[model samples]
Target: MQKLYSQGSRLDVSMPVIMGIVNTTPDSFSDGGDFFSTKHACDHADKLINAGAGIIDIGGESTRPGAALVTEEQELARVIPVIEYVSRHHDVWISIDTSKPAVMAAAIAAGAHMINDVRALTEPGALAMAAQLQVPVCLMHMQGQPQNMQANPEYENIIHDILTFFKARIAACIAAGISFDNLVLDPGFGFGKTLTHNYQILAQLAQFAVLDRPLLIGLSRKSMIGQLLNRDVEERLIGSVSAALIACQHGANIIRVHDVAETMDMLKVWQMTQTQMIKQN
Candidate 1:
């Protein structure tokens, strides 16, 4: 079993945990503008928590491909209220999905338990800010900026390159005073990869455990599932849940997803089967 410590709270990853996605942006790839307001976002977060989500990931800016940049003030306004509301009402963990140092700090002050940076904290001052916050940080790997990530994504060896990136980021985080137990790693699917690259990462997802950090995978209703199954965003629920089950089998520790209830149901069944297998063995 692996344990992740955040703000003096502990999360046991003996089984895969669900990190529910709550996009407060107007242009996210899926469910954008659905929870744009603080009340709506908090309501959606309540549903996710009721549905067995262990973490609620609140994102202000959309990092979707071809997405534009949002100002720091705008981003803060979008997410801080939601974080405050959830923190005040619920006892669940809150993860702030941002790559900006200021946003990270503000979110932490607003009662966020974790930092989920799509840029892997490569942005200026992000690493130091996370270290200073002393909370669990998820470092995701993206080959390029959000605006042009998918324009022409390429890699000599996708898995190797991602592993190398995680290694360097882990070293940087440690040097900046973040403890190893407070770190999580995410191989950014759909961030800067072709269909082939995305599938390749999924197939070899377990290899990431070598980093000795919890792995967070976000594959809910993504273009990878849509493109593969010929389904639209709203129509990709089955594919999304199936992909999440596959990720759990491949040793994903945290599954970041849009369909929280469905994913939690699948994980319950998967956990039951694993327990049976262990007993039989």
Candidate 2:
């Protein structure tokens, strides 16, 4: 079995795993204010754990396009209590999603097991802080800041550019004393990509396996599904689950999603069939 170790938490990744989303922001594109309170967030984490999520990803700021940035203090306030609660109550791994150095430090200090930075640790002091924390860090590629990323995104060659970006970020992480084993890669599906770009990434997700790091995909309930199917947020469950399964088939090791129970059920059936196919072959 493939194992990912972070701050004493070891995860089995031989098959794709689910990382449930717990957004504590009021403006997140999906389920924004649903878990904005500490009590509510803790309850949601409990539900996700019961649903078989291997990791609980808690985010304070909303990274949706045109979203406003939150203060470091506000971000800390939103996620720390939940992290403390989950850490004390659940045995599951906890991922702190933030690009701020201080927030990263505080969250880890408060008992988060890993870091998931959308800015790829490019923010000031972020890379260094991550290196010092010595936890699994997910480096995601984004074209620009959330506020203006979707304004007019473009690329010379989408796959080539994203691969190059990952290479550089990987090199930077290694140079900063973070071992290669402690790194994960995210393609940032809806952060800055258009509908075509998103689909192209999904279709070619297997190409990212060449990086040798586990790929973490987060396309659940994103605009790609919404725009393609003309479904609202509450109606994109099927599309999100389908996209997640496609990503897993394409070599994704971790799928970050909002609907944990449905995703868990889908993976169970998919894994059973895959096991039977291998046995027959």
Residue-level lDDT tens digits of model 1 in 1-281: 89877766778886899999999999999988999988899899999999999999999999999998999999999999999999999889999999999999999998999999999888899988988899999999998898899998999999999999999989999999999988999999999999999999999998997888899999899999999999999999999999999999999999999989899889889899999999999
TM-score of each: 0.98, 0.99
Q: lDDT winner among the candidates?
A: 2
How far off is residue 177 in model 1, in Å? 1.5
- Misplaced by over 4 Å in model 2 are none
Off by over 4 Å in 1: none
The TM-score, computed over Cα atoms with residue i paired to residue i, of candidate 2 is: 0.99
For residues 168-251, write the lDDT of model 2, one tens digit per residue: 999999999988998999999987788999999999999998998898999999999999999999999999999999998999
